[model samples]
Target: EAGVAQSPRYKIIEKRQSVAFWCNPISGHATLYWYQQILGQGPKLLIQFQNNGVVDDSQLPKDRFSAERLKGVDSTLKIQPAKLEDSAVYLCASSTRQTEQYFGPGTRLTVT
Candidate 1:
């Protein structure tokens, strides 16, 4: 009966520094997603996972970003050598088959 959980609700880092965000999806949910939202823009799906396998990652910046779902339960997203453009809110969402998604409180990253 719990929603997704994300760590370090806010982060501040210098450009080029690395950062990682964690997410724990709701129980019994089979789909998990990671999204990025910049100011004034809607959230963009970065990666999606069905269980522990990747379903889509076309929008993910592979050169600087990576994500993984562990044992079909939890996930982590990492951005290495972060850019100023990477400053945004990272959102985690999960859903069961044929159902609406539940979102986390998100991690807000500030690149200075």
Candidate 2:
């Protein structure tokens, strides 16, 4: 199977600016997730999708963070008016009910 794909592995922006990250998960996976990982900390789930519907987005900061998976294949995460504390690795991962989860390299965002 092909691996997870992500782009712009690194990004730098000033506080209150905006940024977005993209992800294309492996073929045939039924579950997708977007997570924020702080330095030296475990990844925290931001949003989760089962097919094209949102299964969970309890941790997502609705005021500034938003995401979508229109075709259930590729997804995008956007943060408007980004904050300095938003600096972290944004990871995209996928899994099937019968398989283990796989992660992408992640987009590391830095806010000044």
Best by TM-score: 1
What global local distance difference test value does model 1 have? 0.96
Residue-level lDDT of model 1, residues 22-93, one tens digit each, is: 999999999999999999999999999999999999999999999999899999999998999999999999
Steric clash count of candidate 2? 0
Off by over 4 Å in 2: none
- TM-score to true structure, per model: 0.97, 0.96
Clashing pairs in 2: none
Output the TM-score of candidate 1: 0.97
Candidate 2 C-alpha lDDT tens digits along 1-112? 7899998899999999999999999999989999999999999999999989999999999999999998899999999989999999999999997368899999999999
Give the candidate number with the greatest lDDT.
1
lDDT of 2 at 29: 92
